[model samples]
Target: MIEFDHVSKHYPGGNEALTNLSLEIRHGELLVLAGHSGAGKSTLLKLIAALEAPTAGRVLVNGLDVGRMRRSQVPYLRRSLGLVMQEHRLLMDRTVFDNVMLPLTISSQPPSDAAKRVRVALERVGLAEFENAMPITLSGGEQQRVAIARAIVNRPSILIADEPTAHLDPAYAREIAALFRSFHAAGVTLILATHDDTLYSPYGARRVELAHGKLLS
Candidate 1:
């Protein structure tokens, strides 16, 4: 379980992203964050992964305080999470397999074990045959899939995506949506922030709207 207890995030230069917001997300819930740009949707997601700290209040994940975790603990916290941020951030020079394997390279897992896991992740994303392909060669939607594969290579229990279906055509968007659904069906805690009504409105199990950093509903 994750809880945001009266959380407020104030950036440098007096910009407040969130204001005394409190929310609770149970495990394995498909929660969608709905809002216009700058509504603090991304900020809310960042707090979960501890990419940003709250100026006031606490964010607790399974009884561990996110805001107060040490640097060494942050990596462990993130290992339990799969993140697909807006940017693909894939290395243009790297092969698809290499991109997915990057996460495991930091661990004590052996090369053979890591390689098998990478292959499994690629297979799940339906890109097993494209492991040798370069990111520069794939289409936008395929590139997004690669990013998703990289995120899940760690076998994270919780998945967070920011605008997962953005910038894709209708068919491609639908495909990606279905992919996310499969993950949810497999019992991964899915938290997605999207402005696309097709995704957040009729798609997610629960929808929470935000406006100017406050929950609207």
Candidate 2:
């Protein structure tokens, strides 16, 4: 479980990205953070990922406080969380298999084990056939799938996605949502930050809606 205790983000320019926010997310829940641009959805995700620290309050994951964790422990904390971005930040020069294998490589896993895990991840994302293909060879949706595969390949307990389906068509967007549902069913806690109404309105999942940095509903 994750808890947000009066979290807030204040910038050097005096802008407040998040304002005394507090919420709780149960494990194995598909929680969607719905909001417009600059509505603090991304800010919330960054805090959860520990990419940015909260100016006030605390973020706790499974009873561990993120802000108090030592610098050396930050990477290990992050390794337990899967983060997916809107852009596929794939190394265009590398094959899909290699891209999915990057995390295991960074963690010092043996090449043989990494290869086995990468293949399973690619197959799960329905990109097993494109394992040898470069990022440029795949469609935008396909590349996004590769990104999702990479995020889950590490078997993180929590998954956070920021605007993951922004570049896809309606059909592909729905497909991605379905894929998230599948992951959620498999017991991974999922949090998605997005502005797409098609994803939230008539919403099927638990949601925290924000507007202008304030919780709206």
Candidate 3:
């Protein structure tokens, strides 16, 4: 479970990205953060990931206070989350398999085990045949699939996507949305931040709308 209690995020130069935001995301729920740009959707996601600290109030994940965790504890917290950002953030120089193997490599998992997990992740994202391919050589949608595979390679309990389909065509966008649904159905908690309401509305996920740093719905 994730909870935000009177959370507010203020950036440098006194810019407030979120304001007294309070909400709870239960495990296994598919929650969509929908709003126009600058609605604090990304900030909210970051808070949950512990990538950013709240300026006020508290953010908790599974009863652990994110803002209070020690630096050494951050990695363990992140290991439980699979994050997919708007940017692919791939190592353009690396093979798709290598990119997907990164998280396991950082954790120092055994090579054989990492390889098996990497293959399973690639297969889940329909990129099994492209493992040896370079991310730079793939199409936009395919590259996004590689990113998704990389995110899930560790088999995280929660998946957070930030505008994952922003750069894709309609067909590719739908494909990515279906991919998320499959993960959700398999019991991975999902929190997706996107401005494209049409893409997620049909799935009937709970919608949390934000406007000017505050919850609008």
lDDT by residue (171-205, candidate 3, tens digit) is 99999999999999899999999988677778868
TM-score (all chains, Cα) for each model? 0.96, 0.95, 0.98
lDDT, residue 144, model 2 = 93
Q: TM-score: which candidate is best?
A: 3
Rank ordering of all candidates by lDDT, starting from the highest:
3, 1, 2
* Residue 68 C-alpha lDDT in model 1: 97
How far off is residue 110 in model 2, in Å? 2.4
The worst-scoring run of ten residues by lDDT in candidate 3 lies at: 195-204
Error of 2 at 185 (Å): 0.9
Q: Model 1: what TM-score?
A: 0.96
What tens-digit string does per-residue lDDT give for candidate 1 at 1-217? 8899999999999888999999999999999888899999999999999999889999998899999999889989988899998888999999999999988997667899999999999999899999999999999999999999999899888999999887888888888778888898899988999876565456557888999999997
| Candidate that would win on lDDT | 3
Please list the residue runs of candidate 2 whose C-alpha ends up more than 4 Å from where it truly belongs after superposition. Answer: 200-204
Lowest summed lDDT over 10 consecutive residues: which window, candidate 2?
A: 195-204
lDDT of 3 at 215: 96
Stretches off by above 4 angstroms in model 3 are none
What TM-score, to 2 decimals, does candidate 2 have?
0.95
- When 1 and 2 are scored with TM-score, the better candidate is 1
RMSD to true structure for each model, in Å? 1.2, 1.4, 0.8
lDDT tens readout by residue for model 2, 1-217: 9999998888789989999888999988888888789999988998887888899999998998887778898898888888899887999999999899988988898898889999998988899999999999998889999999999999998999999999899898988887877888899999999777456435457878998777887
